[model samples]
Target: MMRSSVRGFSLVELLVSVAILGLLASIAMPVVELTQKRQREANLREALRSIRHAIDAYKDASDHHRIAVDNGASGYPPSLLDLSSGVTDLNSPDGPKLYFIRRIPRDPMNGDISVDAIKSWGLRSFASPYDAPRSGNDVFDVYSTSTEVGLNGIPYSEW
Candidate 1:
């Protein structure tokens, strides 16, 4: 009777396979992390954009003297909460629908949605440090609170 030999990978082959896998994992890990970071940054950007847009809309209406202006808080909502809670009847001189953002988004890096703490999204109003509301009113200034380096070789705050 003739004996037949079964083939199996050698120890060297197994070692080489393991080495390749390790190398691949090392390469893939960074890419995955970068992708996640970018995604978060993108989300933060979108949130900021949404808030800014709402603020601008409010400002335009206010410029036309359509929306009522708040004296204590200025044209901008007193707090971020007002964006969601709806402006008080006392705050609105023109109408009550001058709310900016429906709900503030949490900072991707810090995951903070609290209205007090400065984060990514900032509402545009006369008090805002950036864009003023039409004339002197600062509509909004969206800035990333994150100090981490973004994928684009720029800091999140700079974005």
Candidate 2:
């Protein structure tokens, strides 16, 4: 009987292949993690910018007499919800509601999904100090509540 040839990878070759694969995977892991971090950071920046712009819009409306306010009011919104929930526009014939942002974005840096979007952010009122943010009667600005430091060496809370 003629012998049939069988071909297969040697044990050493298989181990080497596996080792190479493991090395490649090891090299790729940090890159994957870094990418994820960058993405989240981007989201955080966008969220902050959106909230800030909405706050500015509210103040602008109040300044223009479009939204009624007390004589000494800062013209800022009373709460984050006010931005998305809409406000009465005095300029409209029927007092139509004026909308800023459709929805307040959750803090990307904060992984607490149980909290509502409005609560996910750290609120800074018109009366609060920048170095020490605190919620007050009016929401002057919004920031990430995360205590983690960013890749740029800035605290997420200050971002």
lDDT (Cα atoms) of all candidates against the true structure: 0.62, 0.92
lDDT of 2 by residue, 17-43 (tens): 999999999999999999999999999
- Alpha-carbon deviation at 3 in model 1, angstroms: 2.8
Cα RMSD of all models vs. native, in order, equals 5.3, 1.3
Q: Which lDDT tens digits does candidate 1 get at residues 27-50? A: 999999888988988887787777
| Candidate 2 to truth, TM | 0.95
Task: Please give the range of 10 consecutive residues that has the lowest summed lDDT in model 1.
Answer: 130-139
Give me the runs in candidate 2 sitting further than 4 Å from their true place.
93-95
Q: Pick the candidate with the highest TM-score.
A: 2
Model 1, backbone clash pairs (residues 3+ apart or across chains), number: 12
Top lDDT: which candidate number? 2
Clashes of 2: 0
